[model samples]
Target: MKLHAGSNILLNLLVAVAVSLVVNFSYLLLLLVDQKNDPAPPPPPEEVLRKAERLQCGALHVSPDGHGYLLYSGGDSIYVPMQRIRRLGLRDGDSLVAEVSVTHVPLAHPVMGKVLRRNGAEFDYGSLFKRPAESVVLTLQLIYYVLISFILLSILTPVRFRYSRRRFIVRCVWCLVAAAGLYFVALVTEWRTGRLVFNFMTPRMLDYVLLLKCSFAVVVSMLYGWVYVLIMQQQAVAMENEQLKNEYLTTRYNMLVGQINPHFFFNSLNSLSMLVREKHHDKALTYIDQLSYTFRYIIQNGQNTLIPLGEELDFIQAYGYLFKIRYADKLFFDVDVPEEFRTWLLPALSLQPLVGNAVKHNAITTVRPLHIAIRVRDGYLEVANPKAPKLETEPSTGIGLENLRSRVHLITGREIVVVDTDTEFIVRVPLQNPAL
Candidate 1:
């Protein structure tokens, strides 16, 4: 929410000026037209006495007439028409409620003057300045100043000055200082010229004080609003950046482990070489097809955060075809995937590595064929293989299992698990939905 100091200063200035102008313009219309000097005039003692008699008569009488009624409270009496009181939405006496009525005096009185001639409803400044128009103008100007001040301060504070309490306070002080400057300029100009600037003072002084005050008020309000909005925008951008950073690190780890397990690669290559050496050219081409399929699936889908569990299982089935062809009657696989789990997601190549591990590590022959199974249940993909370790002397890199686990963890924030029982080695990988 922190705002640039220069911008904050400019904004406060603009807001102060705008508020001042609005106040000046409203007073110009409502109060300034009648402001003037006038000679002395006489009083109306008789009408005042009649109104007082009406108040007292209504106060003592049970009912003045069907058309009017009286109310008395705290040694004061008021007389009002029954219709008017009803129109005011009053019932009985409700002390907490306020009642208001407006009374207007005629701009011209036939009895007071030499019957002043008029053109298009000309305003009367009134005798001896009895109307006190300057007071009305000053009240309006004060109200305008207050409204502008509140708006400017609200906008400039808090969100804009988020960095430090002191900075926010400083920004507010500047706005008030600008207001005080306007007040002083007006007060001093009045003292010198015998009139406030906006109240028809000379054009030069009027332009200077009015323009500066109004412009400052408007600019300050806009700056505060702009700073607050921009601060929120920056915060959202920062959060997005943090999220992307975490995703990048996760993707990098997945990529490093996603490289095909070297042992599996070499073993498949060795199997293909043996097929060709035995002059089984067609079957070697079939093994080549299986090898190509495995690599292509990984390369194409590895960048994907989620692939359908069905797709990974399909790749496993294709790899199983190659293993069965190589071991002939000595390799078998069973699939137990539920229809519901088909569309559920796992990390790309998540299942293939576990099946590859079973094929590479287990012993299989015509008399003792290896058995592998793939199943989906309870939001997990379960791959179980017969525990028939064949290459006791072979060193294990453990890269394939670790790669699967890393991918799962990166995408789902859940663990990939391996379990071995007396007869079966099982891997369970948690499933998820794609980002879409």
Candidate 2:
């Protein structure tokens, strides 16, 4: 089943908790069996008993045989008779405080103590670590479980996501082999260090139990690893989809920009024909020179996704020259970008389209001249033109502005800002440092 990110986190936590419970349950079973086979040490040494007896009503545990009990105080356990069980009724598995006394007694009835109060389970964790070597071994076992779990989650999980079905199966098999190898190493270490000795089970039975525990841990690790792998796979698929969408948008924008070139060439040729018919030979020569320069710039850089702002400006100036010759004193173009920001990056041919759009949609005559200005402000390149909407003109395809906006968004993840008013129209393209 597919799970959300939150559910994945919850599942991971649950797995950890389950692993802990399993380990603790196995240890508890081992502890019970060990206690059953070995009798409690005969009433601690005399000096130890004396020290224990001086302490006030401390913890007590009922004997497994139910014939007697052990009273624990000051880090010592003193055997006590059942008769001394006083104000609080005695029972197996009940923790309580009792007054204890040291004395020589018969084997049939050794303890001599009085029960004072029942205090439920003593919760004395220190008692579990009474033997220094056993405590160290237990600590090492805990560390081993934690380390194995972490490696399975952090390392194997990613590997599963990165491989195919056949490879993943092979990886899983290898992981199991590694886990078994590590378990064997741990067993050898414990055995060599004399930490595997158990009073309850025979050595064969002990080996079988250890094997069972290790097998359970390995299985749990694999299960949790699969869940993590599933999560990683889902995230990877999502990222891939996003990248594909961005590529589609970029291609669409480029196609739209490509359409502008044909229409621009047709308009420039019409202007050139007019100049030739009017017998303006010198003006026609200048127009041809400017047109060639502009076309060369476009041809050289049109395929590039981005170019330096200064280069784009140079292309725009050459393009503006063609329009100036066509309209004479009726059209004007001004550029005021800062020198420091000239090296900033921008989409190629981004500004020329805006200039062409202004001339196409607005009437340019001596009675009412058209003015276009390009400048930089507030980390954006501003292209502002005075509005003079044509009453009778072909409807706009809107491809120019849309293409510019899409390219800007795809490249920088930022939108181009447009502001239109009755008197003026402005487009703001965000500037980006080339070094970044």
Model 2 score (lDDT): 0.70
lDDT of 1 by residue, 149-184 (tens): 655655454433344446555666676666555443
Question: Weakest 10 consecutive residues, lDDT, candidate 2?
Answer: 122-131
> Which stretches of candidate 1 lie above 4 Å from their native place?
1-237, 240-244, 250-254, 261-264, 391-393, 433-436
TM-scores for all candidates: the values are 0.55, 0.59
Best by TM-score: 2
What residue pairs are clashing in model 2?
Answer: 80-111, 81-111
Over 1-436, each residue of candidate 2 has an lDDT whose tens digit, in order, gives: 4456566555555665567457757665676687679965433234343677443444456665555455454565566555544323456545555454645655543344544334533323233323345446556666666555544444455432464567557667877877666555553223322434332333443366557666777778777676666666776788788889878876776686688789789999999999999999999999999999988888888878778999999888889988888888999888898899999988888898799889999988899999899999998999999999787886899988887887787777899999999999999999888777
| CA deviation > 4 Å runs, candidate 2 | 1-208, 276-285, 303-308, 338-345, 377-380, 389-392, 417-419, 432-436
